[model samples]
Target chain A: MTCPEELDPVRLLTPRAREVLAAARVVLERDGWDTLTMRSLADELGIAAPSLYKHFASKDALRTQLIALALKEFGEGVRPVSGVAALVRAYRDVAAAHPQLYRLATSGSLDRDALPPGLEDWSGSPFLEATGDPHRAQALWAAAHGMVILELDGRFPTGSAPEATWDELVTHFG
Target chain B: MTCPEELDPVRLLTPRAREVLAAARVVLERDGWDTLTMRSLADELGIAAPSLYKHFASKDALRTQLIALALKEFGEGVRPVSGVAALVRAYRDVAAAHPQLYRLATSGSLDRDALPPGLEDWSGSPFLEATGDPHRAQALWAAAHGMVILELDGRFPTGSAPEATWDELVTHFG
Candidate 1:
């Protein structure tokens, strides 16, 4: 099987593929993972359903690509921050900025085994290094994931002290 | 609205209600909250779809009842234990025994705003009292909820060694 070199770091996508991805992100942000059907995406992009098939084989393929894009965006958002405290702050900032996308990324929307060919390896290194221990890294991921969910669900107190829980979480990491 | 008289607290349900709840739990366990249609639950119980409507007004009504059942079962599971350490142990035991049910309870499966008529006072009181401070109660709930999700997702360590992370959380309450 030939690896999709179109996804390589040095390779650039054609303009139409870029447009498809941009439209997919809008669908993801607006309707979330459950409603992001290929037909819906085609409708959003003002293109025929068959056109999406040219860019992505199926809904699962489209999801894999969307997840890859979300992870890359997440990495970019958090890259400048250093240390656990800063990392936690960065994570919270990124999550708050893209609440729906973050929820979709963490909500088991994409099957781990079906990740875009090389994308899993590319994504793991930064997260693995952040927590030092693999077990702690996984726990931290859950904690952060839960935090985003709680925030979105309005479980956090709404008042003057908006960032209190987030500040406490950062302190725990430190 | 007339309150249903309290039954045998130990049993927590009429025999028929228990049968309905049991079928509901099976559906929830096999399929997560999103797919728990009223028709599906009736089909699972070998009853007509309309019969489920006799028991539960809607899917939300069924979910609210299921959560109430889960909370009562959870309260009973942890009642025999005392203090923070024992409470933490009981938390893990209940989570392990009924992983899906536990998820349904802690995750926002039940609409907090539209909780069943008398359930507002019944939910989480036992666990909260075990923690004493209201602030710490919220944190303890978050930690326990986060821990159980991680455990159910197979992120927790496999051995029987007590989790230091959990111990630290309990320490905050003690």
Candidate 2:
């Protein structure tokens, strides 16, 4: 089996790409986007920074790839559920499960203009489709993003359950 | 009409406090929270940093004072609106009007637990009252915060009419 670093670019091989993405996730989780430099990633893999250009062209390229990976993971996590309520729960669960990646993905740090080809179109499609209204979809994304950031910051009501708050949001929209 | 630096501690008037707050706002807007040091503020005002200590004991004290001023401005901006639709519009306007202050106020840069007496309690009251549900209120704040941040970041849909998005959100909740 070819390692992720040596895999062919054109074909889909889940395990290899998954390994690279997992390493990227570790970089995002431990050091955050600010410190997730190419050098750092290369160091993590015991390779030189320039060698990373083989997998990803630039820092932004690496970030965009990681964001794409995150969105794919996000889509997968929310795939088992359907409808508004289940969708809301799945969205919240994905955010909670990968708080760091969620923050980095939604932090407005990635340039929409520079979003990798085909990735931007699919990033928020799940949530948007679930809401059934573009405006509501935008608002729901903002609300969920806000909830996760506030939750991570420890700004939400102390002792107030996350699931309960999520239920109220769903009810309000419903 | 004494300058802020000349105001006596016990006898300082509202206008004097406003002047100091304005200086603080300038610091926040230009340098952001990280570089908003007393010396930098004093340099902006052409006064000694020690003089600032008379008005605000520390950076935390100055930040809390600024948060109070920001909340006051925010409250005043949204006070006249009635019903949920009006409230959402008013909230959006406040955010758009002072994007920097809005970011600072909601950035979790301040110490919530050490908030000055009566400051935090009164600051978010208007928002809480508008939503009428503690959970909803919390969600609303998060949503509003995220909306402004994303809007400023230019992540929201730009082409066509986006105000319709707000209208849809309001309709959904109502």
Candidate 3:
């Protein structure tokens, strides 16, 4: 995932900090959010845990950066689709492509204060642009998110393809 | 919630184990699954952690019980609704009521091997009953789940009521 210069929030960080962010993403995708720790990330980076503190003050701080990366990548993936059905498909594909990052970015309380301004809105503009209504877009986005996350979590019945469900969701809004 | 005699899986447990299960529910809802430990359950029960193991062999074993309990309660809550709109509403209400348990039960790779046979099907029957098609029912369930989880996690924009989103989903499926 090439972070386009304009949309890249990590550019503000020092070059070494950016490397840490890259490594963190690898760790986050390889290991889940719960198991990813400063110690784990340090081991991933071939550095001591104390040195990680210099790059990222804490795990929470490091996580904030990782979320930004996920947002950017997810946003880029989902932004280009033209219609409701296509948008849902793109959303699901992007999420499926990076299930771990998708879960991390979507689940739990988001710390908006720590994120760069408009980054959230810009990341989400594709939904509004597709649906042409904020509420509808949000509903569609929520529905799409729900399908992807449930599929990722294995909540749907075992041995059943979720295509019909996905189609049902798209048929509803499309 | 009163678990119906036939529906209650916990009925298989000994009396003391039932008490421990009840206490475990309280701690799970209060502290969340990650923070929940055998030691914590023991403390909640006023017994030593080692003694708690007498009731359940491992945390995974205990969690399966908790999952059973969640399936029963969620099934009970959602089973009676007659239509897609009402089913979605009831699902959202029940999930909102027990946010922690909803997350615990719904997220992750389910251990079907551990859960009682037919418990999964019985719990999910409401969706099929309401929709009258397995695929459509699964689709509606996934859409509703998407809305509930996003709302629970504060994924929707701050201060948004999400009513329109809910209405949109129901309108699609209904």
Candidate 4:
């Protein structure tokens, strides 16, 4: 899928840096954010930790790149903006497909200063497009996020998806 | 406030164990769950880590106790259940009051088997009491959770509370 230029924060990275980031994503999926150390990432890439640091200064910088990637992919996965149900469905599908990325990008306070300017807003613009009102969009987005997160964490009681819960959310917003 | 018997998971713990859990809460708030260790709790209590282990076998068990306490307090905080607006208000207030504990309790997969039987359900029963339908209740709970978590993490654009978004959530459910 073609990512919008605004959403593609990694576009500024050199080809080798992009490769390091790709490896980082793999490591993040496997080891999670907490365990994704520079050494571990270097080990994954078969490079010395010092060499890896040349590509990305610290794990935090690497994490910022990953969050940008997550935003780009998640934004793409949920757009072009459509009806509330479709948006919610797309949101859940993208997050469910990339649960690790979803949690890493969203679970903590975002380093807005580090992230590319307007990239967060551009990615989240689809929510605005769907609802036409900021508050409603936020509510819808949060509801979808809550459902996706709870579902991913298996916080829901059943083994199966909570289809009815999702439907109720959509019905209210629709 | 009087806690319902089923909701009080810490009730069965020995006096000493309860004191250990109390110390853990202080440490958890001061340092997040990731930083909260047996050593830290023991340090807070002026004891050694071994003493902490005797009270709670591992950090995970201690975490379970914290989750139980969070759920009990959160349950009481949101009740006695009232209208959707009131419930949403109460929910946000309670979570905001204990952001650290709220994140610890709800962020990951719950160890239902390890928890006191029926405590989770009893704590969550307020949602059902408000909505009168399981799916709707789940949706509302998820929405409230989503809003609260995002707010706690300062995910919203403004530092001020997203009152409009929260009202939108309540409007739909109410």
Evaluated against the true structure, the overall lDDT of model 3 is 0.82
Docking class of 2: medium
* Candidate order, DockQ descending: 4, 3, 2, 1
DockQ, cand. 3: 0.73
Model no. 1, DockQ: 0.25
Query: Could you tally the backbone clashes for each prediction?
Result: 0, 0, 1, 0
Task: Flag clash pairs in model 3.
Answer: A146-B146
Residue A80 Cα positional deviation in candidate 4, in Å, after optimal superposition? 1.1
Instruction: Summarize candidate 1's per-residue lDDT along A1-174 as a digit string, tens digits.
Output: 222354332234467887898888898888877777778889999988888888767877766666666666676677655576777667778878886777666554346555545554444344456767554554455455566666665655452114555555545554
Which has the greatest lDDT? Answer: 4
Candidate 4 local lDDT, B1-174, one digit each (tens): 457775588778999999988888888888998888777778899998887777887888888889989988888888886778888888888887888999999988778887778778878888998899999999999999888888888888885447788888899999
TM-score of each candidate structure, all chains considered together: 0.75, 0.73, 0.93, 0.95
Candidate 3 ranges with C-alpha deviation above 4 Å: A1-7, B1-7, B159-161
User: Across residues A23-76, which tens digit of lDDT does each residue of candidate 4 receive?
Assistant: 989988887777888888899989889998787877778778899899888988
Please state the interface RMSD for every predicted structure, separated by commas.
Answer: 3.9, 2.1, 1.3, 0.8
- TM-score chain B for all models: 0.73, 0.72, 0.93, 0.94
Native-referenced TM-scores of chain A, all candidate models: 0.76, 0.74, 0.93, 0.92
Clashing residue pairs in candidate 1 (N, C-alpha, C atoms within 3 angstroms): none
lDDT of 2 by residue, B62-172 (tens): 776666567656766777656777778888888777867877776554565544444554555656777787777776766766677778657665722277766766765
DockQ of each candidate's interface versus the true one?
0.25, 0.50, 0.73, 0.84
